[model samples]
Target: MERKSSSSMRLPPAVQAAALAAVGGSRLQKEFAWMSWAGTVWRLEGQSGAVYVKRAGDLKDERDRTVWLAGRLPVPEVLGLFGGFGDDWLLTRAARGVPLSDPSLGWEPSRVARRLGEILRDIHALDAAGCPFGERKLGHVLIHGDYCLPNVLVVDGRLSALIDLGLAGLGDPQDDLAAGVWTLQYNFGPGHAREFLDA
Candidate 1:
């Protein structure tokens, strides 16, 4: 299904202040999360560093999962979290490199497929014992439940970071595997999907 763009939705005033505070009152804020349905992301270039501020409604499980996985995974560091009127904003350091969805990167389909495969394999191989939400006895590892192409960032042709962790929890590993394959096919076509499965 086609998703609607949030290009027209300007960040609410409260959210903007929160973002500015996150970076010590920096004024450089750019809207960047165009395709996201869960929330709006702002790229804030502060005096100290760059951070991506995510504003969402009823965060539910996303906040906890992010905090839990911060030191254990290659995710962005959560600098702060604020809640107001049933909405929440998450401030995190900017992820390194470009997202796999960036067409300008000109990555070959097969190469992207291979990298995604390796990422999934590595994630599934992590020790579930340390995962607060994983049910290890059920053969579930800490899977990126939304392991789609856009959620993965590639740096120098390798998986650098994984974003969007609201759905991450104990579940069948195949869910992540299938989502990865589906994303490959959706983004690069059938040949790429086949290559990913084969790899």
Candidate 2:
């Protein structure tokens, strides 16, 4: 199977040149998990840190607006965005934290499960009253389309950063809670899954 290069997404001249330089016009070496249908995933290393590149994802405008609006919120920063690469390409700064899957956090399944639940709920509690980004209407919110343990990063045994906003859209907070439930089942255990879900 031949892997596709999402080079067609629109990009700023500098970003395009950087992409070309990063992949050497051959093929990118890293691929992140599935977050959406619009673009190809790749581990993009930037001057700041590891960045996940979503090419042709049609999220350039939404993401730009959302991040810009949520700047005060506890989300990753948006680095840059482009629309000339043939597809909409969005560049977001990677959040700081180890994935929740890291065994170093806690051995007890219930403990981590509860923590995950609280973290997400807290994020959803952010005041969206004056939110500048119309993501709720534009289809970008708390419930990630592909929310999973790998997409969440935990640092010092606390939820720190979240990745893969490809599915960010408007929906009930339970949507994220449900996804967290499934992730908890996979990470912690089926027994404690409901705790995270019910939270």
**For residues 7-110, could you state the per-residue lDDT of candidate 2 as single tens digits?**
33334576655554543443334445444445565555534346556667367654754474456444667666667555666666556787776676654777
> Candidate 2 — which residues are off by over 4 angstroms?
1-13, 16-38, 46-49, 84-86, 103-107, 132-146, 167-170, 187-189
Q: For residue 102, what is the lDDT in candidate 2? A: 68
Query: What local distance difference test score does each model get?
Result: 0.75, 0.60
Q: What tens digits encode model 1's per-residue C-alpha lDDT throughout 73-178?
A: 7887776677767787777778897877778789788888888888788887776566777565667777989998888888887777888898886779889989
Q: Top model by lDDT, which number?
A: 1
lDDT of candidate model 2 versus the reference: 0.60
